[model samples]
Target: MGCEAPATVGKLVAVNTSGSYLWEVPLETEKPSGGFGCAPAAIPAAIYGTPAVEVEEGLVYVGSYNGKIYAINSSSGALRWVYPREGNLQPVVGGAVVALGRVYIGSSSGTLYALDAVTGDKEWEFQTGDKIWSTST
Candidate 1:
């Protein structure tokens, strides 16, 4: 998967230490951006931020400008689940944080969401009244 940020669709890649690919998964947006013709971003990202890899859980979590989050199998490219299986949220520009079986992330809508790591269910949410761009390191 190319890490270059795309306005519409991007990809998440798992590479070995030797710079070889282990797996690649596509990242898509539910809403299209106006800037669709530009080249990919130089930084490593699915669309806006770096993807979160949870090795112990065998899952890779990524957010898109389409306001959606996806959980993919770490070893395989199979998609495990997606958040807001129906509607959409503000664009998710930050990476996810996985701890204590919860996936925490922020969206452009000025809210933070804590989702069930396994099922992508909304566990809770907090409104900050401002866009959140930073991710936990």
Candidate 2:
């Protein structure tokens, strides 16, 4: 996802999954700024799930295709923590369902995980049949 800085007008933020970098670009009226502003932030991997979820204390949670979920500082794009899942799973395209301080997500491995919303900690896992693709509460 891309966004402009709320404080600075015309400044843009771009997240690149393939390049694993977050770019900050300042929009200039006179000429092109060459897409430069702040340092590039490194993402966990390709993002495939729900976009970053803004939470309390200026934190943002994002899930990626690397089988890892990340909590990063929204303002600085600094990583606070990451929760890794089983990597061998094919993929999880359904995204995450957050409720009551918990995150629910399903993987192509035919399993579901309940995790702590704030810390990205896994609380439980439920395995389903091979024919099942996903589940919900």
Evaluate all candidate structures by whole-model CA lDDT and list the values in order.
0.76, 0.54
**TM-score, each model?**
0.78, 0.54
For residues 1-137, write the lDDT of model 2, one tens digit per residue. Answer: 66332343433344555754464433222222222222242222334455446566565665443445556666676666666733333344456666778777776667787878777778998887652233355
Candidate topping TM-score: 1
Q: Give the TM-score comparing model 2 with the true structure, all chains together.
A: 0.54
Cα error of candidate 2 at position 10, Å: 25
- Residue pair clashes in candidate 2: none
How big is the positional error of residue 69 in model 2, measured in Å on the Cα after superposition?
A: 1.5
Candidate 2 Cα errors over 4 Å, as ranges: 1-44, 85-90, 130-137
Stretches of model 1 off by over 4 angstroms after superposition: 1-9, 29-31, 34-46
lDDT of 2 at 83: 69
Candidate 1 lDDT, tens digit per residue, 1-137?
Answer: 43443333466667789988788776563335432323542222236667788888899888877778899998887899999897777777778889999999998778999999999999999998888987854
lDDT comparing candidate 2 with the true structure: 0.54
User: Candidate 1: RMSD over Cα atoms?
Assistant: 4.5
